[model samples]
Target chain A: MARPASMRRSRRVGEALIERSMLGCALLSVVTTAAILAILVRQTGEFFAEVPISAFLFDTQWTPLFADKHFGIWPLLAGTFLTSAIAIAVALPFGLLAAIYLGEFATPRIRGVLKPTLELLAGVPTIVYGYFALVTLTPVLQKFMPELSGFNALAPGIVMGVMIIPMITSLGEDAISAVPGSVREGAYALGAGKLATVFRVVLPTALSGIAAAVVLAVSRAVGETMIVAIAAGQQPRLTLNPQVPVETMTAYIVQVGMGDTPTGTLEYRTIFVVGATLFAITFAANLLSQRWARRFRER
Target chain B: MQTTVDSDACLSPPYRTMEPAQMSNPGVAAKLSVQELSAWHGEKQVLVRVSLDLPEHEISAVIGPSGCGKSTLIRCLNRMHELVPGATHRGSIQLDGEDIYASGVDPVLIRRRVGMVFQKPNPFPTMSIRDNVLAGLRLTGMRPGDLDAVVESALQQAALWSEVKDRLREPGTSLSGGQQQRLCIARALAVEPEVLLLDEPCSALDPIATTRIEDLLGTLRERYTIVIVTHNMQQAARVSQQTAFLLQGELVEFTETDALFTKPKDKRTEDYVTGKFG
Candidate 1:
């Protein structure tokens, strides 16, 4: 069974070349991440030289464009948190229920038809959702409440929640489906009804995957740009009221990026500072999700 | 009742309806009976006109080679067969003289009365050992005032209490394969079923674990009518009081375990038991 010496040598050399190419592909991603970290830290240091960290973090106002500027980040942070919280509140219950229905109860014919249609929602561009929020949803809200502003957080937040619904539903369905059939049969043999099995056994078993899905959806909502920029106004008011207009972290970056601020100015550099803050928040969210998911992971 | 002339005409009314007095001369009550039962997986028929009577509070074993429909027969006892897609069945399965498949009977109630343990150990991975035992009660919404006593006694019945009592709060998956299987048994016993069905329960266990589970079954037989499916001929001889041999979904022979092993009335049964052919 021994191979010839020359053929074996050539095969060994080919394997080494393929192994090195794969290693290079893997290092590319690591190097990209390191480069992004370096650039953000360098620009963030430059931003802090002119503006103190305390003022940037603790100040209530975010009026970097005004003649007398107040460089606080609270208003934008508040807007980001508020919109994301609202989106989660809307998405979690409906998305999870849909997933349970699809995974546990749907007939094969219905599931074949419904699953792809639900996933098609994820394929639609966010810009279309932004247009829908501004033109259609805003009017509907104003009719219900006369105090509703033309460009308000409520419309954009609701639209953003709609956009992420398919993400949670698809991922949650996969998690539920991954539960072992033996465990489910055990539940059934113990006289558990359909609802009991779904709620107690299947949902709990899939909790880690569902938690991972929710965290990923929250990260998506936090970094969403077009929906907030178009539907939610450019005003960065530190108000909890959904009826009023507010600007999010992503919206502010887009706002500054489209403006005529000169290169190297503090006003121009504000985008990177805001970008770093958003990146930190999303990174923390991702870490928290992985930790949460690991706790309930199936052995 | 007279035996019918054409054996394939097994589903006729008189043949299907056997009087309780006509069974064995020892006269034990029949807890469950399957008469002229036939099953199909989709369009393919897998079982044909199989019939047997299971005595109360005793272990009866069904032995057969692979693809012989042993598991399917047990599934039909608890109406688990109907859960499969496109599966259909003919004939009646009676529990205490009531046809379980008759109009207006709920399969859920039948399952509660007849609990099953699968070949593989499947404890609820997300649940603590204590919570796994309480799952049946929690799911059925029949919580007793003193939950600790119920959990302790169920685990004690399954012979897993001493090894697990100190760490009942740990996840069920933390235990060894044998302990996990016993936990599953304890969970099934928590509901207090009238009949317990085990489908090759010891197939996944070591010899020691298998012996422990078999010993527990000896004790459990005093209270519950038990039916087991086993591929191991020695296991059937050791544990079952009566044995039913099946071949290609037909009931080839049904008799006392000793008689069937020592003096098989049919050549097919003799061939199977002696390892001549499946």
Candidate 2:
């Protein structure tokens, strides 16, 4: 066999091969995320020039409210935040407890059934759920609060909350499960009971991952469209009252898109502006989760 | 209850029969007696019928080759063996004049009185150093007023107080390998148990750290009964008054340290002592 001409040259060749493999995966991940961002920015920028970014982000009246220069975004922004908050409030206890049940308390047979069923919930189409919320859920909820309209923020928010339950439960369960069994055993060996072990030992260890899961689900909730469009009224009111009609940023985009508005016109351009803002908000949430997760990674 | 029978015949060694020390201080009492003990995990029996006695306030060393069930036997003392789904034991062991496995006795209480140190240093990761020491106290349900002294004494006993006193609130894992092991020892001692069972306490430590732990073990023998499981013949020879040699789950011999190391009674023990095989 022919030997290498020089040891130094051969070592450089080996190092280059290893470096290429290491950076290849990193490059792929960075490039993919960058491409998606670039596409959103390019398309959204074109939409913004016609509408004028100021009118789109900070106007008081959102109409098509008045037809000429009534470009308020507060209504949609408020609606999105309100719905997401409500969803978090509902999901925090229900989804987290469900995750706890599955991760800690459930027997194998029960866990086998529950996890996939939660997954099935995640797989259900938002449009179909939208129709269900508008027809079945709205009327049922209206009976409890007679003042509630046929299409209201509460119904859409509740549906959105239901939509995200699996996101919270599944990711939270994974975080809880990632806790090393030795940590749990240490607590158990100390004579701590199951609940004490879970709450005091397991939960603290898993908190960062769970927090990341919650932020990600909130991002998903903020970016939801079809269900909110179908069930939430397109009033674009800056109100926190759940029973009242409100329009989310996503819902308004769909409302504008579906109508006969001219494609490159100022009114039409507002949709992309809304889309860019939605994109920014979700990106911010994603970054926050990533930072929190990295900060808490085991040393 | 004790005698000096130059034990080269019973111990695995570089057997050095050191100058004689006083026999049976008579201060330490025999706390546990093991009889016809056998253990199995699933269908595979891991330990043969093994028997030995552990006296209070003295260190008893159990040594053997890997997989000889040294760890399983210690775990049996406090009922940790039952924690494994398929593990089962057949035998009788008495702690403090009471049968630990007898009906009506609580393993929880037995564990509190007979604490353990793991092979690797596992200080509870989530707790502060002070909190880690007090974990056993909290497990047994202690009021805050009662914890301060217990935590202080336990750390002092483990020889970790001087190193960690300034940073009591720091996580237990922030400590180095030897420090973590000593912290774990402090945690076990926090409950003020009568007996401490160490399963290879020094196995994960470096030579200097091993020497520190060995010194701590000798000092600790003045107050608490310690049953140590070790692979190091020098460590057992240096620290243990009574040494039991286990070969393939069987206790081949148990005798005074000097006698066992110098004049082994069994041929297998002699062979092991002479480094034919561990």
- For model 1, the local distance difference test gives 0.88
Model 1, B180: alpha-carbon shift in Å? 1.4
Q: lDDT, candidate 1, residue A220? A: 94
lDDT of 2 at B204: 90
Q: Model 1's A-chain: what TM-score?
A: 0.96
Q: Relative to the true interface, what fraction of contacts does candidate 1 keep?
A: 0.78
Candidate 1 C-alpha error for residue B200, in Å: 0.9
**Candidate 2, A1-299: lDDT as tens digits:** 36566977888899999999999988998999788778667767776665676876678767763546577788889999998888788888899999988988887789999999998999999998899889998899888899998878888788889999999999999888888877776666666667877888788888888999999999999999988888888889888898888999998988888888886676776777778789889989999998877865763
Model 1 segments beyond 4 Å from truth? A292-297, B1-26
Over the stretch B1-278, how does candidate 1's per-residue lDDT look in tens digits? Answer: 22212332332322232321112313567799888888999988777778788889888999999989899999999988888889899988999999999999999999989999999999998899999999998998887888999999999999999999999999999999899999999999999999999999999999999999889999999999999999988999999888888777777766678877997766778889999987
Q: Is the docking of candidate 2 incorrect, acceptable, medium or high quality?
A: acceptable
Kindly list the per-residue Cα lDDT of model 1 for residues A1-299, writing each as its tens digit: 49999999999999999999999999999899788888888888999999999999899999999998998999999899888888888889889999999999999899899989999988999999999999999999899999999989999999889889998999889888888898899899899998999999999899888898899899999999999999999899998889899999999999999989987999988888999999999989899888876764634
- DockQ in order: 0.76, 0.37
| lDDT of model 2 at position B105 | 87
Local accuracy of candidate 2 as per-residue lDDT tens digits, B1-278: 55534323333433212211112223346688787788999998887777666777778988888988899988898888887768999988889878999999877788878888888888777789988998877756766586778888889999999998899999998999999999988988877778888999899999999999999999999988999999998899999988888877777777777767898776777787778897
